[model samples]
Target: MTPQRWVYLRKLLSGFPSFPSSFSSCRPRVFSSSQSAADNMAEEAKKLAAYSAVDNNVQNNHVVGVGSGSTVVYAVDRLAERVRQEKLNIVCVPTSFQARQLILKHGLMLSDLERHPELDVAIDGADEVDSELTLIKGGGGCLTQEKIVAGCSKFFVVIADYRKDSDALGQQWKKGVPIEVIPMAYVPVSMTIAKHFGGEVSLRMAVSKAGPVVTDNSNFILDWKFEHTHNWKEVNTAIKMIPGVVETGLFVNMAQQAYFGMEDGSVKVRKAPVN
Candidate 1:
């Protein structure tokens, strides 16, 4: 919306004291005034971090990759806000069905990787982020698509709540490396993974369904709990050697930078380690 139009709207709205604050019925009800939202520290932090990422990096970002998961939800929301307020001409590429739904829900212009193969930047959430900015993602089973989208972006930026930032990737996110694999090969693949990595590999069971959780690609998910952390790139490479493995949650050196939302309503940014 233009400032002149905003001023006109404000004049029209000032007459009606009883009217709702927002006129857009399409917008989610969760967002209100920024100061009031800061009362909920965690949510505020997530919003602050997400908004900061979008505000700073989204300039001239014609093609953007929108990620799935909770934190990225805020990023999508902020993106939509910018689209409405500033009229940013950007097309969003979704990393998963969930992300696609968010794009549609917010009325953001949506496209696919086929249409925009290279993204100016990607905003994603991580299960865990280390000091070096190594990430553990795919907790939502969108790892394969997420990695693909991130890999195609000029800048892969991660946004998350403070709890996700840790001294090491495995320290905070204890769910283990989420691996996407073919259905029939899950057993053998799990066995192979355990044999080599010395971790308990288990098929991720669905809480709402009877059997294992499946990815958007209809592949089975295997959560491998390593006994401890090691060199991430080596670990990711070794796991990828298994014949049926599609992708692992271990995002080795993929992120260019990360924004962590702090409890005190502040945001912390960690750039990738200089190699």
Candidate 2:
């Protein structure tokens, strides 16, 4: 797709119904003092717009993949609106616990990934995204399932705010790339990340609990901080080669398009070049 067309498509895809219409009456108003709240509203609007654009292009009864994270909350809301409006008949599949909650709370019908092996579209959020549309995901600890859903879907749409788009993936998200691994592999993985990968890595510890952070799948999480990432594909491949590594946050060539909300109340979309 041409760059101009990509932007146009993004605006259309991210278009969503207003909050009060999709979500229930309990929808929280944008807090005047909270930047996060405002950002969330903008993000949600962009996500809805993106969903609408894609929904119109597809036939009825498409199975959709819903991803985890705060931004994807809006995506779920949009999907629910589509269902409520009867504009679409779709079986929604979730990537994690939070995603499931959004589906349930929004009153959308849910389906299992096992039941619907082929998904038409998957909507998700990224921790960071490079210019080429490569992403660093899993910040909410749902990378494994998110990747699974995205891999199975014919189109993967990522929704994020302006902060997520970057010159490079690692440069935008400084919290480090979240890596899910077997609990027993934490120490070994940490060693490899530091020695072989030449970066500072640390086990993510739960502030509320004494042990390391536990993922939705009962695995442990490691946050690896690389001072410089010259080759993201190589780094991602190397991490995947390690034993006991369940999944890395690095999402290379998975997204077909992205919608980012600007501070000025406008939304921008970017589409990957057609192969």
Candidate 3:
């Protein structure tokens, strides 16, 4: 779907009753303010700080893209605090409905990529990150817009807990790389992914519902698990050549850097050379 049509589809989905009210409201009782949950969240918050340490470049009127995921909640909170304390004026873009809500709740100015074609920076979370900085994202089903914003940004900063870091992209995120595809093309796409990519491929099924997982863009998700990835760029190019593929989770050479928050609250930063 076109980006404009995807936005419209998200608006329509937002009106649906089945969609959870908010991330907080959807959480299970077990995680509600429990000591373990709080500690984990605190560590995640620290990770977010490490992620946002990118030079804000405030003079240029930064246009930032925020992504969706449990870990990214901390990044939103930190950004909100920064906005309040520094009185920073910036245009914030979102990769999902949840992200847009975060932008509003944090009092950051909302912007559409259509209005701002270029983005200064984007801070987001990944399902997994390899030593080379290739990533597996879209576990939250926002990969399409996330890729758009990350691709458009001058720098993309990824934030995650230590568990997400891996020697290779598919190792940590064993659920597989999430690929957004046209609903009708799922079978062909899955077959191609398996035959050519030499991976296990499956249509992501909704755990709560009986059908396939539907993305905010009204697309189906295919989770492809490759035992090892030799060339992420080649994998990305191959997937894009498939007619059904909308976007893939493999973020090859797109990230400028990453920050991983350890369980003990220490943050580690990794940087790539500027081209």
Per-residue alpha-carbon lDDT of candidate 1 for residues 1-275, written as tens digits (9 for 90 to 100): 45643453444434433436576752343234222333345566788889899988897547999999988889998899999999789899999999999999999889998889999999999998888888888898899999999999999999988778899767888889999999999999999988988979999999998998989999999999889878889989988989999999888888999998876556888899889
Q: Which ten residues in a row have the lowest lDDT in candidate 1?
A: 29-38
Over all chains combined, what TM-score does candidate 3 have? 0.81
lDDT of 1 at 149: 97
Candidate 1 residue spans exceeding 4 A from truth = 1-39
Q: lDDT (0-100) at residue 114 of candidate 1?
A: 88
How many residue pairs clash (N, CA or C atoms closer than 3 angstroms) in each of the candidate models, in the order given?
0, 11, 0
Ranking by TM-score: 1, 2, 3
TM-score of every model? 0.85, 0.81, 0.81
lDDT, residue 254, candidate 3: 91
Model 3: residues with Cα > 4 Å off, grouped in runs: 1-60, 273-275
lDDT of 1: 0.85
The best candidate in terms of lDDT: 1
lDDT of 3 by residue, 167-212 (tens): 8776767898899999999999999988887879999999998999
Q: Write the per-residue lDDT of candidate 2 for residues 9-116, one digit (tens) a residue.
A: 445435433455565553443222244544555555566545654454334688888888877776676667767787677788999988888888987779987899
Better of 1 and 2 by lDDT: 1
C-alpha lDDT values of all predictions: 0.85, 0.78, 0.78
